[model samples]
Target: MLQESHTAVIARGQHWRGEVATEPYEAAWAKEAIFFLRALKVEGSLQGTRANIQISADGIHWADEGSSLAVPTTAGEVTFCRISHFGGFLRLVVALPEGARIQVVASLNLKA
Candidate 1:
């Protein structure tokens, strides 16, 4: 006779965020989970810098989850976008002007 094995995993139910530069950044992969946008922080000196959010299932092809967000050229500026959706994977695609440098951070509330 053959038997099946079962295991249980405790859901993290925690929040996670990733930081990236203007050169383009991708977040870590998340398994069978849902996420909610908490906040976005933009810092550093640059011009016409923007942060774009994207989601993917295989990490090969990506789709824009939302519109491009404008980033302040100056520091001490934060944008709040509270959106919720379920995805197998999530990442960020940043756009910067020529010779522009900026730092972007995204926060997400994870649920299993």
Candidate 2:
């Protein structure tokens, strides 16, 4: 069978200084997805830079799927997490400590 897949750049070279959520992407057709966050530059504390996976039906409200992505802290490092059984929309809620910041890119890959 021919597989269909797509990738969305949720965040591009963006600087996150505090807790923030990546822009949600609609992927209802996908049977699987992988969320990636790459830290190109880091500042302040190195630990506790993680994200909570969230799903939404209408792309409006969201709830944690009880899964978290352990993001890389050092530059030139990448980390990802796979997810399934999702809703129409998906996003990651990243938590950053006070005075902590990271320049990174986030992407979501979908497969059907």
Candidate 3:
């Protein structure tokens, strides 16, 4: 099971990586899942730049699941991403435009 608490940054910058592993491995699989990704805060000046979020079942391979939300610097905070119709163990990876430093928070909800 994944902890309810937020996991901190595994890496920061243009390319960031983070992973959440399921314990008691057999129970991790679910019929449906939703992942909530929130950009808690951003730094290092995000002028005319955007960020991209990606997910992978295995860390080595990744596919663009698409951004659930995008926050232009001029807009308010709280960017989100949602991935539905997924099963098995999962991992998330974030890619920011060059020279962008940002921190995001994410959580997972599973339904059997």
Candidate 4:
């Protein structure tokens, strides 16, 4: 049987936001997991210089798993990518380089 556990809470501020979590299971059960991340309904008059999303297993350590996902918005909502991978732990980090306040919504799906 496959199961999931919430290991962290993700909240976004006016500038940046992120979260991390881990799920333990038999390594032989599955090889990888798929994470669907999105940046939705952002409203503002600021130019987003850059937006980045990344994942990590150790929590303290991280890797640029979802780097190519970025959307520049002056108004309206924008969606990013559907990233899939395998790891013991997982985290989501988003950065807005322009320093403008941004509203973001994100979620993750884990498989093992």
Best by lDDT: 2
Give the per-residue lDDT of model 4 (tens digit) for 1-112. 5464331224332233332222322222334443333344454433544444445555567566554445436434544444444455444454444434455544443344
lDDT, candidate 4, at 101: 48
lDDT per model, in order?
0.42, 0.88, 0.43, 0.42
TM-score of 1: 0.49
2 or 4: which has the higher TM-score?
2
Task: Sort all candidates by TM-score, best to worst.
Answer: 2, 4, 1, 3
**Consecutive 10-residue window with the lowest summed lDDT within model 2:** 42-51
| Prediction 4 TM-score vs. true | 0.50
Query: Where is model 4 more than 4 Å wrong at Cα?
Result: 1-9, 12-50, 72-76
Q: On a 0 to 100 scale, what is the lDDT of residue 58 in model 2?
A: 89
Tens-place lDDT per residue, model 2, 4-104, is: 99989999999988789988899999999999889989888858667899999888999998888876789988999999999689999977888888998
Candidate 1 wrongly placed segments (more than 4 Å): 1-48
* lDDT at 100, model 2: 84
Model 2's TM-score against the true structure: 0.95
The alpha-carbon RMSD values of the candidates against the true structure, listed in the order shown, are 10.1, 1.1, 6.9, 5.8
Quality of model 4 by C-alpha lDDT: 0.42
For each candidate, how many residue pairs have backbone atoms clashing (under 3 Å)? Answer: 0, 0, 0, 0
The residue ranges of model 2 lying beyond 4 angstroms of the native Cα positions read none
